[model samples]
Target: MRNHSGHDQADHEGHGGAQPGGLSVSEHGYTLEFDSTILTAGVQPVSFRVIGPDGQAVTEFLSEHDRELHFIAVRRDTAGFQHVHPVMDEKGTWSVELALEPGDWRFFTDIHPVGHDGTMTLGIDVAVAGPYDPRPLPEATGIAHIGEYTVALDGELLPGEPSELTLTVSRNGRPVADLQPYLAAYGHLVALRVGDLGYLHVHPEGEPGDGATAPGPGIAFMAVAPTAGTYRLYLDFQHNDVVRTAEFTVRTATAAPKHAERHHGHHAHH
Candidate 1:
């Protein structure tokens, strides 16, 4: 749909159909290939490459958000979220160390090849060998505490509609007004649907140098949920020259008739 950092994908070659990314391993003749799909649990090195239509590892890429590629790893149950950058060799093999647990994890790459008209996100699943115990999704909440900072979310996600979400940061009950720019913006937000792990990467409303934009207490974003369901949000922000992530679980707010609302309330109380 209307995803991808507030840009339309219709102009892209392989993005004719409007849909969220990270649901497939290959798209637009590009495939995400891993050296191995199975690994032992713990912090270890992982390697992978992007094979282009010509069946060669892609080496040239355009930078987006101040980086050539963005790597994301998360458990299938919407736990263990990590956003990190990996180093790519001349042969196009990307290497990074991840603290992986015993479970099924999804690895996503957001990249823009040199010749490609636009950026794309590709995903692959890997099995970490060991005892696997999946955890249930956490309950929805608006407040997230990371270290000594507190982040409060205000707004709702509406299905098939663009919703504005604002996150305010504070420390010890004082507003944080000196947030440094991370990835060319005040903050970066990543949203994944609970079931399919559909991905949406969004940036803030304005950039750091823009005169109208403030580095401050609230970062605003426009997000469109593909459907009515639960979602896990990860916000990466930088302050004091250090980056930190704040996590939150959110549910789409759907408008219902009065009687339906009453029924839902009654059912909840019963």
Candidate 2:
């Protein structure tokens, strides 16, 4: 068997990787960029950065809280799953020694400030080649705000069917398109298959919402749950002078397509 370092040694510590009070990718748009191939086991490492709106750095380390950068990697088919912590070598260059199989994979980072409500984020798709994208957004139907940063969602879910999760993001009760580069990407979206806490990393196709236009009606990346489960959804976005956290619980569609089976830990019910 080959040894891979999807997550670091520190990641598998005290609280089963997912901690109670720490950084857990609360927001969306934590940028993930690097050569998928790790040239050296010890030297040739991965590189990337995450910036905050206040012109500060949103680090993976949340000592005042808990874990540093909480990263979740799941293949499009949900077959390959990695819950690893990339060591921040530089400003935003988080490095890890995980050899990934040739396939389309998505990376979502949960970032937060210790002792504060500032949770910044981003998501990126890793292909051997090509620019990133989200062609069309999932259509948002019964939208509600359960008091996070923006809107809360009320939708349907099914097993073995492709389902779209339409999301609307805004601040101060208005569309927040012109959302600045939070973390390193535009916006961030994370979807967990309800009960078992399966992970889905969803990214915005286009730039964030402009103050002129509505922030979203931004569709989240699509996914299908292996088994019917109650999913919890969390989104992180930043604009103006504040960072917003929008959260909700959703059930996968009954007609949801069939994807690979991936397992995850319990939700950190903050």
TM per model?
Answer: 0.89, 0.39
Worst 10 residues of 2 by lDDT: 1-10
- Residue-wise C-alpha lDDT for candidate 2, range 1-270, written one tens digit per residue: 000112321232111123211123323333334545222222234555665445445554463123576666544444344545677755656766455555565565655544434433345666533333422322334454635445645345555443555566654576655665654334455555532344544454433333433344454444343456565455666566555556555655554233322211223332
What's the TM for model 2? 0.39
Q: In candidate 2, residue 16 scores what lDDT?
A: 19
Question: What is the C-alpha lDDT profile of model 1 across 1-270, one tens digit per residue?
Answer: 223323553333222234668899998999999999999999999999999999999999988878889999999997789899999999999999999999999999999898986789999999999999999888899999998999999998776656679999998899999999998889989889888888878777888898998997999986777778898999999999999899999999996445556777999999
Best by TM-score: 1
Checking candidate 1 for backbone clashes, the offending pairs are none
Task: Report, for every candidate in turn, its global Cα lDDT versus the true structure.
Answer: 0.85, 0.46
State model 1's lDDT.
0.85
